[model samples]
Target: MHSPSVSHRNAVDQILRYLKSAPGKGLTFSKNRDLEVVGYTNADWAGSVTVRRSTSGYFTFVGGFKPEKPMELHCDNKSAIDIAHNPVQHDRTKHVEVDRHFIKEKLEKKISRLLFVKSEDQLTDILTKAVCGRVFYDSLTKLGIGDIYAPT
Candidate 1:
């Protein structure tokens, strides 16, 4: 923003081109045999070398006909999960004071349960990191997105 460069312009152009090519691409929801709301969260710790800030994201699924239980939220970062469940504060977690307390309160009320998930299985990875072609497609499938025009 301070100094827009040629690369930044090119990146914007590339995104525009992609959007033009896939104008119809989007998510579609349908009735299924199971009905449950599951959430997945992931964080890329220190992903940005410039600022050493982490990137995190979460996605939720609703309705499939199956019986539902208390919502379960899967997080790949054990530290963040621990912070959400732990009532004590520490120097290292001072940066996330607000989020810590909010998530802790939710957990205490049994509104949701936090569970650990391996990085590879974390679907939110697609939003926070650059993944391979296969992985990207897998993430799309997990998110219930697919090429509707493709032959079955």
Candidate 2:
């Protein structure tokens, strides 16, 4: 934030453009009786050509209002889901041991349950990737975002 660059400027411009395009679009969290919390998480491992670093994103929503029961976390990566469920450690999984253990702890405490979701159904993809137009709008609709100015 202290030092700005051309890339950062361009990114900001893009965000502004999106906001301008959807001036009345907003998310609606309706009152519900169910208290089960649902979440989606996705990671793009070593996706950047220059940095070779992973980009992780998650979308969590409380339908019932509170997490009275185990929070359902949907993920697209089978390996990550397996590692979170498995206790036996291997060198190959050491890189993500910290994250894995955190999730494992949550699973043990019944605070969260990690489950597999198809890539197409993973809502977090909109945050981590440049998806097709259909996917973009579909995800927004799923997330309860709507354009208030649209004709009824």
Candidate 3:
């Protein structure tokens, strides 16, 4: 690296703080017969204070060894869900990137189904937003994450 600034140091500090705050956190999986796969996706549209660029993320969970049936994808943005379901492209959808059309293809093939979810219930928020502690822990719990080192 040629040069490092205060911003980099601050970022490292923030990461260290997060690690220290949750040292024992881990994911646990057990034997299960149902192999249902569910995914949650969200985008912070122009949520950045400095650059105003949208950032998106997704999280998926598989209950067993093999995924069964059509994968359920939950999204908080209704417009995105609509676009994914609509077969006919409109003028407004012209600006959407080419890669996004993959979702439409998947939908048409019955590989996945897109569903609308409320913002508060969007489990992907923990990955994309600086949510409060309550929301963060709740999301983690919903995702089957637990503290492995906790006393029994």
Candidate 4:
């Protein structure tokens, strides 16, 4: 969700800088880690003013996987959940519907339950993958991204 003229490469570089500058800085998966994935997923749902397409994003975990099982995705969209739950062939969602299959199957196999998270609570915002320095640093701290940045 950025400017139309912004090239993907530039975006990738920006994200890379934030990640690399703070080298060895990341959320590590360790036995002492007590936190769950606490993931968030979101889509603009017809967000493209030009194409009417949506962009979706979600984060997987603290360690990135839970017990070798997929993380249960929480979402605020009932319609998306409906589309995901049914998995029937439909026109409106057909374009971006492929991602829903995993969740649908997860539900059927009792592997996941789509919990509803309020928009404000979703942490997906911090993960634009490209952001300004201050914004990047703010998100970094918010996600507990640094012992590296902590004052010495």
Give the candidate number with the greatest lDDT. 2
- Ten contiguous residues with the weakest lDDT in model 1: 62-71
Ten-residue stretch with the least lDDT total in model 4: 28-37
Expressed as tens digits, the lDDT of each residue in 10-71 for candidate 4 is: 87888699667767587633465443445667766576566776677787656544544545
lDDT of each candidate versus the true structure: 0.81, 0.87, 0.83, 0.65
Alpha-carbon TM-score of each model against the true structure? 0.78, 0.90, 0.84, 0.59
lDDT of 1 by residue, 1-152 (tens): 57877876996998799778766667888766775678998878889676696887889887764436667899888877878878779989888898888888878887778999998899999878889989988988888787756667
User: Taking the tens digit of each residue's C-alpha lDDT, what string does model 3 give over 14-124?
Assistant: 989988988998787878787788889998989867668677899988777566688999998888887777778888888784746988888888888988899999998
Superior by TM-score: candidate 1 or candidate 2: 2
Model 2, residue pairs in steric clash = 34-64, 35-64
Worst 10 residues of 2 by lDDT: 60-69
Residue-pair clashes per prediction, in order, are 8, 2, 0, 0
Model 2 RMSD in Å is 1.8
lDDT winner between candidates 3 and 4:
3
Q: Tell me, what's the RMSD of every candidate?
A: 3.4, 1.8, 2.8, 5.2
Per-residue lDDT, model 4, residue 29, is 37
Local lDDT at 73 for model 4: 77
